[model samples]
Target: MDNIDQIVDARGLACPMPIVKLSQAMTGMEVGQTVEVTATDHSFVPDIEAWCRKTGHQLIEVNEAEEEIKAYVKKTK
Candidate 1:
């Protein structure tokens, strides 16, 4: 997890909540930093992907378990 700057737990929240929290957590990040967002919402896979695509961030990886989903996002530009 070298170069990972922050971790955001967005479990229990839905929709825009996770995105909002991720946005806040990334507010102070310098360009090229990474954020790991762990979510309990299964749909977060596409949600986060769309968010990253729209925001110009990079989705490093996506890992999903039976009860949770984890997205590794990096600020690209």
Candidate 2:
């Protein structure tokens, strides 16, 4: 895994919450900074992907475990 600048623990959060927190965190991050989001919501996979696409961020990696979904996103803009 790449060096993470921040970690957003949205494991118990639902749908938009994970994305919301991600956006909030990214607001304070510089371009090229990476954030790792760990969520329990299964929908986060597509939600995070869509958010990245819309915001021009880079989705570096995605890992799905038995109980958690992890996504590493890098700010591009």
Question: What's the number of clashes in each of the models?
Answer: 0, 0
Q: State residue 7's C-alpha deviation in candidate 1, in Å.
A: 0.6
Q: How close is every model to the real structure, measured as TM-score?
A: 0.92, 0.95
Every model: Cα RMSD to truth: 1.0, 0.7
Clashes of 1: 0
lDDT tens readout by residue for model 1, 3-66: 7789999998988798999999889888899999999988898999899989989999999999
Candidate 2, residues 1-77, lDDT tens digits: the string is 86899999998987789999999999999998999999999999888888888999999999989899999999998
Which residue runs does candidate 1 get wrong by more than 4 Å? none
Full-model lDDT for every candidate: 0.90, 0.92
Q: What TM-score, to 2 decimals, does candidate 2 have?
A: 0.95
